[model samples]
Target: MTCRVLLADDHAVIRAGVRAMIQDIDDFTIVGEAEDGKETVEMARELEPDIILLDISMKKVSGLEALQALNRHSPECKVLILSMHTGPEVVLEALQKGAHGYLLKDAAAFELRLALEAVRRGDRYLSSAIVQPVIEQAVSKVNSNAEHTLTQRQLEILRLITRGESTRSIANGLGLSVKTVEAHRAQIMKRLQIHDVPGLVLYAVREGIISPDD
Candidate 1:
């Protein structure tokens, strides 16, 4: 079956480059392109592509916002985030928001094809450079200490904080107010018994909430 794809990015050069890379794929077809997040959302609904490949840092409406809109309007169309930012916070935010896969902008052509195929098969994919260590560390930590007091949401927020996301960014990404994110930050710190951002980052690494790459 042919997989219809929509490419969304603010840069014409990037969209063109990805089009060049993907145009030869046997079962993948580029059905449309959008230069911004809002256009992405609109094209996604109108075109009904099987997958959307988008950058995270669009100008007016961010890719995260487009992902949310897709979730509401076209849940069947999978979203794959293609970004230059490899921060764990950014990756996790995309996953939590409903991205089927995440790939770095610098990913090799083979890896890009692999990610597209994986998501088309209804499997999640991540850049190999970041996935193995993250999975191993998370599994090891969970096995070593299965019981934790933090709620999953709190842990997620903590991970973002440790990954260097500002509270406002976290709020915008998660569709919460800045004050709500700040409250969650305070609660996370209180629960972890860590008062400072650096301390929280250290704790998150130790607990495997995020990798040490931050």
Candidate 2:
């Protein structure tokens, strides 16, 4: 069955473009649409799509806020942040707040489909093109001992692994080597001083990353 999808964006043209691209994918179908975060949340509740694609700077509530609300009301519904922001901090913040995936607004249609599928399968999806810088940022944060020491890529990989993706699967999905993914995992665990999977999950939850509600 095709994965039911909801699109929430302030721009009609962008939404139209995304819909046009998604139409080419056989495994996805747009079941609902909303123009802003508030409406996005409402339609999401009513439509109950398997995934929700949101734009961050909506007119009413921001996508970040909408993501949190959707996760709260319908934890089964996954959220993908498809915004123009490419900064490491912005992506990490969105993921930390409750987004299941992140992608650039200019990303290709196939990438959008991939993001939706990954998130729907209880995994995470981030634009692979952006993962390296995100990882570097995370490592820096960890070294700095910041309040939430995570980069967007590390958070993405961590969420995917915690959601049950294997090292090879994560590498394939993110376009990285299995060794590289394992290295990142080891580094994350070491920096956080987490010994195992349960500890990792607890740390993620405690730090406001992915939630059990997610």
Best by lDDT: 1
Off by over 4 Å in 2: 143-214
- Local distance difference test, each candidate: 0.81, 0.80
- Pairs clashing within candidate 2: none
For model 1, residues 23-114, the per-residue Cα lDDT tens digits are 87779999999989999999998999999998999989999999999999999999999998877667766876888788999998888999
Best by TM-score: 2
RMSD for each of the candidates: 11.8, 8.9
Predicted candidate 2 versus true structure: per-residue lDDT over 28-115, tens digit per residue:
8999889998999899889999888889999979888898888799788888899998898887778777787789988887787778
Per-candidate clashes come to 0, 0
User: TM-score per candidate, in order?
Assistant: 0.65, 0.70
Give the TM-score (vs. native) of candidate 1. Answer: 0.65
Locate the minimum summed-lDDT window of 10 residues in model 2: 139-148
Ten contiguous residues minimizing lDDT sum, candidate 1: 138-147
